[model samples]
Target: MGESPHAVTSLPTARQAGCPFDPPAELIEARRHGPISGFTHPGGKPGWLITGYDLVRSVLADPRFSSRKELMNVVDFELPPAPPGEFLLMDEPQHGRYRKPLVGKFTARRMRLLTERIEQITTDCLDAMEQAGPPADLVTAFAKPVPAIIICELLGVPYEERGSFQAQIETFLNGETGEEELMAAYTATQQYLAHLVAAKRAHPTDDLLSDLTNSDLTAEELQGIALILLSAGFDTTANTLALGTFALLQNPTQLAALRADPALTDRAVEELLRYLSVAKSFMRTALEDVELGGRTIEAGTTVVLSYNTANRDPERFTDPHVLDLRRQDGGHLAFGHGVHQCLGQQLARIELRVALPALLNRFPTLRLAVPAAEVDLRPEIADIHGVKSLPVAWDA
Candidate 1:
């Protein structure tokens, strides 16, 4: 559904300095200029990118707009037909039905089960990190592993094979360095999950995969949902962990606030997610004729909603660029708003809340191992944006 004649006003290109997926100084500067605007994607595709806080929120909440993943680009990746029964691409009634049963499992109460496991994982990673000496790349040692291990445990993944899974996910997210590698990584992940799910069917465990297998749903449906869980659950949380740490390091006042009152860790995580906008942008195809922010959007046009831009809209947020954890009204669209608001947010919050406070309390002297600006943040590689390497120094 992409041949719509909907005319959106032309705005500047969405290209940031380092990567297309990141929010550069330009986009932030533009957000201050206006709310809803246009931006040419790097490939010269005229994308109706929603930047205004209220406008972005309206698009996500509106049923007239669609979030199907296929209409991204006709010339893009030629993968196999998406497997059936996977509900991620479904809109409206179908999307609602698929998500209804699964939402309960992600509640704060259910997520609390993983708190101890998260701590154990964080401690193990840091313990090994201490053995690595000072000026360590925390991305490899702590930031990366903490959430990976926690997610693995939450989904009942075999922790022993964590290295292989981590490698696959990394290749997929490393947008610039690995295209061929990304496809291979995705295929390997499917095979790995296929084998893992089959085993779970035979011997049911108390994990999400096992639960999905044992559910009354069809086999195909189980596979589709399981694949979504693996892709979204792993990549989003891992990005947030690294990006959130980098954000706190850059803003010591927020870091110290959490260090003082660890109970506010949950709120601080929300603030971090709001401030960093780690997921970047999501694509949508127009399902029918609809106008947004004075632009005539016809049926079947592709539009991109930039969470990074919307999160910092000054109209809805005051001093939008700065990282303010004490903000009471800062309900940023770091997670897309409306029906597609990240289903896994509760799980992500628990993981981040547990890990960040633990790290700060444990490593009191923690600081960046390199200059802040030198820390590379290339977001254009994948659907998610974050740091590849986060270096830090602190005495054990």
Candidate 2:
């Protein structure tokens, strides 16, 4: 009922050594103390960190917590409004306007229709990995390319342009690139998307972007939407594939269960989603004073919703830290919740369902090539969490 004794002074960057899948120790400790803890943003603004499953889900669904970029009061300076069609950072009518048109396009049934193509994509990546032999960096050979190609095809990006597009995306999302390099990659991507939007307008094709060309959305808006889809479509799933593979190898019992019963693939994917939670945390600003977890979140204060910890909350899931492929609990926030929940989640699910099993089945002896500690992980600063390179090897 009273304020938590713990106060998070800054965002944690490093995960505990050898515990790559766990949220930062400080965050887990904060959750242990209580669901909501006092937090001081890096920029000196006071805030709260919501680490409980129920509280995080509540904040996500509550309209009183604003998602608008400009409304976030954690930083000292005013933030620019979200670019057009980036509905993740917007709210209400505007978010609905951009999202409603695409809702039907990404439903579970619609994404399932793409299962055949996704299988082929997964198969192709595995074939390439086989030809190249073991000790391959799965991040490049399999994880990154599988989703990269699928998203490219979905957006109607030509095969010739995909390599460059993927490189630019890597630069911006890698989380370790210099500021200048990051901005350059961002600008190049925007320019390319702008050009792609124009091409789609002039010569409509059988792709999601081209389909949107018929809508009332402007080219700029279309470009913004394309950027969102491309980035979200590729990065999150790629990380899940690589990181999930790593988790399975470490938990042979779970891996063997999945391998023995192919029907368990869907459940395994859900368990991995809850375990890894690579998307990590998200920020929301309070539109007004709101009571949460026995504390008041003052108006204009920003709060960090810790998804990783919430997904692993003890009160929510039994043996929360263990990786249990057969675990029956569902409704993880891996893809998030509420109005701004991931648009491409079903597509992501399809890709994971097809790709992960295909990779495991293709290489029955698959395991890490390097020491588990040597596996390079993306820094916490990245919007998405994942591996930089998953070095893997299997018996030849």
Q: Best-fitting candidate, measured by TM-score? A: 2
Scored by lDDT, the top model is: 2
Local accuracy of candidate 1 as per-residue lDDT tens digits, 272-383? 7887787777767677778777776667666777788887777787777678777777687876778777788877887788778877877899998888767776545467
lDDT of 2 by residue, 10-125 (tens): 98657999999999999999999999999988898889999999999999999999999999887799999999988888989899999999999999999999999999988988
lDDT of 2 at 84: 96
* Number of clashes recorded per candidate: 4, 0
- Residue 30, candidate 1: Cα error in Å is 3.6
| Candidate 1: worst-modelled 10 consecutive residues by lDDT | 1-10
Q: Candidate 2: where are CA atoms >4 Å away?
A: 1-3
Query: What is the RMSD of candidate 2?
Result: 1.1
Note the Cα lDDT for every prediction shown.
Answer: 0.72, 0.92
Clashes of 2: 0
**Per-prediction TM-score to the true structure, in the order listed:** 0.88, 0.98
Q: What TM-score number comes out for model 1? A: 0.88
